[model samples]
Target: MTANVNIAIKHTSLLISGALLGLLHAGLANASGYPVTVQSCDRQVTFDHAPKAAVSNDVNLTEMMLALGLQDHMAGFTGVSGWKTLDPTLRNGIGELKELSPKYPSKEVLLGADADFYFAGWNYGMRVGGGVTPDTLAPLGIKVYELTESCIHIMDKPKVSMDDLYIDLLNLGRIFDKEEQAQSLVKGYQEDLTNFQANLTPLKTIPKVFVYDSGEEQPFTSGRYGMPTALIEAAGGKNIVDDVQKSWTQIGWEAVIDRAPEFIIIVNYGDVTAEQKINFLRSNPAFKNIPAVKNNHFVILEYIEATPGPRNINAIKRLAEAFRTAL
Candidate 1:
């Protein structure tokens, strides 16, 4: 080969090696500070990298993932349409990703999707010893992150608060590498809540509110540890059943009537419509003495709003407005 050609070949090789080294350095820089650990319920889960294919259970949890702009990371979601119909906003936010299961998915479902992570909670998707759980899925190479609010099911937790929802968002952000987005959204929610609270008229008497979830023989209601209790207190009202000491539970009409709630929040979901639930309450002679039923003071909150999710802010706003007008 000519000397000139040999020199050109060596120069080209050197340039190619330099380019490869530069790309390697860039990759390392990007990968720095990975392998982060975050708290999930009672467990400490560590993520070596962001999940490529994750599956969130239920409408609220799924919305949490979507809020962080992590839709592309999801394989699909489950445990929504089986019970409550999706609101337009939730539908649009999820885009074209399909529901893997209309209800709680089986173990095979997650495996079929090749999901690397599962976002679920106790009774949200998996029961305490159900077929699908963190222990069950861990063997199959799927990491599970339990919802912060639902942690009360298995572990001792503080009284339910808006912070429960915020904690989930922050943990999800850490897991999915969307910390900035999560922090911004949480700050906005906090600010909006603060601003709304600031304009409130200090009530000499805070209205007593009761949440009617669903039940025929026994009325299902929210208690001290339920999300509704926190929402109610935030909206300048007290959940009449806050003394119940459980999250969601069924109680006798006598307890409800004894409390004499001034306002009732109907949870809209399942086969039984919110109107039917209210109608039953209004027509029942036994409950006629209750302040809420007597005055026909009631407002409906979607299942999503009653649960822990982004809709909580709007739910609090709506409840505050309803409380003001109902009295």
Candidate 2:
């Protein structure tokens, strides 16, 4: 070949190589920033990439993933009852995903799915002694993103609020490179809260609220730290059990009678329906003369909203409207 032609070819090859090298460096920088590490529960969780195969335990976390448009990334799921209670649009998308179990899957089942990430909370998915935990799974290449509300006991944040939902969504967005979507969703929630609070101007009195989770012998209720406490306060209702200083606790009927709450918030989930709880309250003579029972004032919320998720804002809106009307 002519010397001039050889020199031209060499110059072209060098330019192409330089361009490719620059692209590779940029990609590496992005990768390094990713699989981002955050302290979850008591340990550090690293997301190497947005999980391609993910599993969500329980309906609350499942709906959270769905709301983020991350269902396509779900490899499998469990906790079927919550799925049944989801909105029609959300329910329609579940036909394709694999259901690992009706309840918490065994450790072997979780391993078999080879999920890159597991969206679950302690007790809600895998119990502590079951041998499957974030620490145990980390070595096997599966990391866990725990539901934030479930972490109050383990983390520095000991209270629950809409902030829990905001942080969880934002973290998921960062993991998936969808920060814009996360921020947009949070903004919408903030706007809804602001608008709802503005409409509460006419509420002259704050109702005393009794949150009913379950139990015939003892009434389970939202204590100082659960989402219900935050929701009740936001709705202009003072929680009668706010002094308990725990998430959900069982209180005596006499204590409830003494409180004489004007409103009762019944949680809808598990084997017992909200109607059953209301029935129990009405049938029991101990509750017969309670102001809430006498007035038929009860706000029924799905257990899903009782936890932290996108539906929490809806819970706030519903309670606010009910309180406004009742006032």
Candidate 3:
């Protein structure tokens, strides 16, 4: 994690103190609510008691569970090491736990772990019509809380917004009986974003930007519905492909040339290095005249930061600074 991002609740002032702090432990789990039901995407899942053995998938969701101090309740984590390497901050939080699988776990893999609760989302761990959806796991006695941002894959949903991130945190708090911690983090994030935006230098005009996720023949990036759209908008920039109705999808290089973005946000992860991706754009004769390429105006946002996670606040701050510098 970057110096600006706090994986744990770092703002002591934003958190509760005195007697209210007592609820953070397992002793008062019922204080939040038992048999509590919360909406998860299209369904209302009920939790009779706080989940004792939870398994989170992907770096972002796992970080969220860790951020709320739910590692004690977790049996293990899966779907990280296959793609992105864990940074030092993540190592401190997840190193102690078991990694059930490197990538998406099979039903047998999840079942073998004896996980009572599966915190995942569509394509994040479970895919639509794949073996590991809420429907498939229900009969096996495992409950799931789908990531709000990933809901776009299965159904028509609202455009990506910061509230999508907050909703996941709030729902997870309700599910795990950590209302105080969840509320504290959400409140702090909201206030931080509001204050940061209010104090930001006014841009003469919002710059058009393209997110280079990972693809050469066709660029894969966040559309109007992907999390980066909200991130870019929050940072006083616009996603060049926001008009696309899909979320994360592949686009033709011709379309990119048509849009001619002034700045590029590189999604750094997977086999390709950020430096290599930059070199591709810089050396390609086809992209020679693009303003972003010509001016070398680019910002590298980590996969975790570009996706839904605690790092988003700082990611926006970084993008805001980069945008200002580029202009």
List candidate 2 segments past 4 Å from native: 1-33, 82-87
Q: How many Å off is the CA of 136 in candidate 2?
A: 2.2
lDDT of 1 by residue, 105-224 (tens): 999999999999999998899999899999999999999999877888899987787778877877777787776677678778877877777666545567889999999799988898
Q: Which candidate's TM-score is highest?
A: 3
Per-model TM-score on C-alpha atoms: 0.89, 0.84, 0.90
Name the candidate that leads on lDDT.
3
lDDT digits (tens) for residues 113-139 of candidate 3: 888999998879998899999999999
Better of 2 and 3 by TM-score: 3
Error of 1 at 51 (Å): 0.8
Q: Which portions of model 3 miss their true places by more than 4 Å? A: 1-32
How many backbone clashes does every candidate have?
A: 0, 2, 0
In candidate 1 the C-alpha lDDT for residue 73 amounts to 94
Better of 1 and 3 by lDDT: 3
Please state the error at residue 199 of candidate 3 in Å: 0.8
Query: What is the Cα-based TM-score of model 3?
Result: 0.90
Give the Cα lDDT of each candidate.
Answer: 0.83, 0.73, 0.84
